[model samples]
Target: MTDTHSDDVRPVQPLQPEQLGTYFALMEAVSLLQHQVEQQLRAEGDISYVQFQLLARLAHGPGPLTMTDLADGVVYSRSGLTYQAGLLEKAGLITRGPAPDDDRATLVTLTGAGRALVARVLPGHVEVSRRLLFDPLTDDDVRHLGDIMTRVRDHMRARPPRSAAPRKRQRS
Candidate 1:
């Protein structure tokens, strides 16, 4: 306790070059893996991964979904989803129609061609998914990783807003 003032302070250490290199290497690995997967899908099915994802979502959705709903389901921003949907529509894989309840909103539906394409690709997709993610992990590891990811997603969703909630005055 004699001279604690200066002694208590610690110098900040900068990240080492190796640590930075590792981060870059990890990012490169993920990018390369995604590219490989995309190549495989394109070669086998003649469909891009994003297109496949849209088809899959449309196939699984309850009937026709609005453009906004499709965007939400695919986790794409509205504009991006719209662009992709337009591409799919041009490809004759999906169709767009006016929403039943809202004339302004458009509903997206999977065409027969889209359903057939998904059917053709699903087996390969499942195999790839299994090989990439599940085959290497033990059941407990997979369960734990899924749980952790879900927690992270939920935490992100539950972050408090900067603005305060509105309150109503009580009468005595």
Candidate 2:
């Protein structure tokens, strides 16, 4: 491991057993939870998890979101978001157009169908989440978990991921 204070190559220390166990547990739990959530979304709304995220964010936003905004919010690649937006637009669930204020930006907005889809799938989503994630935790445990995750997320977001950056043009 390289020391944070100095740039020197050093031996990496292995994680403690407890730390390793906790890391594995976190990964497994997230994987399982995401799988179930994806299944629920697919069954109910015929949408992928990312697509649902896109729609849900649009539904909750005060107004339209630019494609870049959506990419940052969803932590998805700009190309992938554009493709998904195209699919959603074709389905009449969403509409994408040039931003009124910025011609270079594409704004995404949920249509009635998108809103209705969110409304339709939300109950199952909530039920699945509550049953799988919250049922076993006490109120205090839930609060503590939320606090911990919020801190971790904020720390990670401090350095935005590569996907959050604007894409560069390719030479043709």
Candidate 3:
């Protein structure tokens, strides 16, 4: 019998030496920065990075947002987000309820405690970020990095995650 899947195979280009170096450097830098930020957040608020993200996003929003919204914003799974939201609710940091407009969606709201925690930890968060990620960069470098990151983020987000199939327009 002859193989029939030849058409499915496509040649792909490999990364150049410089491209590989850049990729490794980016990964290492991000990992190191995240580790430091995580340590700071855990030390200050006893919350994981994801938990802080959820709370911080909620705190910044105008009103209660759905779990879907939080999941998309934090780039986390819906189930994982649910678990995190549960932990926050138990801690008296947030509240979860049915969205008035959508019965299938669970809305997450930051409580007073949650807002206070963000305010408490934000100073350390900023300090850690500046020290670890920004201290070596000039203003121009920072601006260029912001532009590059935004473009990269948009490119990645253009393809909706498998978990979020059938994408909706991302919030501005």
In order of appearance, the predictions have TM-scores of 0.71, 0.88, 0.88
In candidate 3, list every pair of residues with a backbone clash: none
lDDT of 2 by residue, 1-172 (tens): 1223356556567778888889899999999999999999999999999999999999998879999888888998878888999999999999988898998899898999999999999999999999999999999999999999999999988996656566688999
lDDT (C-alpha) at residue 80 in model 3: 86
- Which candidate has the top score in lDDT? 2
Stretches off by above 4 angstroms in model 2 are 1-13, 161-172
Q: lDDT tens digits, residues 48-103, model 3?
A: 99999999888888778988888888898877888889999999999999899999
List residue ranges in candidate 3 displaced over 4 A: 1-8, 161-163, 166-172
Runs of candidate 1 with Cα error greater than 4 angstroms are 1-33, 157-172
**lDDT assessment of candidate 1:** 0.78
RMSD of each: 10.7, 3.4, 6.7
Summed over model 1, clashes come to 0
Expressed as tens digits, the lDDT of each residue in 1-172 for candidate 1 is 1123466665546557886787687579668666766777798889888888888888876778888766655566666878888889999999999988999899899999999988888888877777876787899999997998799767764753312223356898
Residue 127, candidate 3: how far off, in angstroms? 0.2
The worst-scoring run of ten residues by lDDT in candidate 2 lies at: 1-10
| lDDT for residue 98 in candidate 1, whole number 0-100 | 92
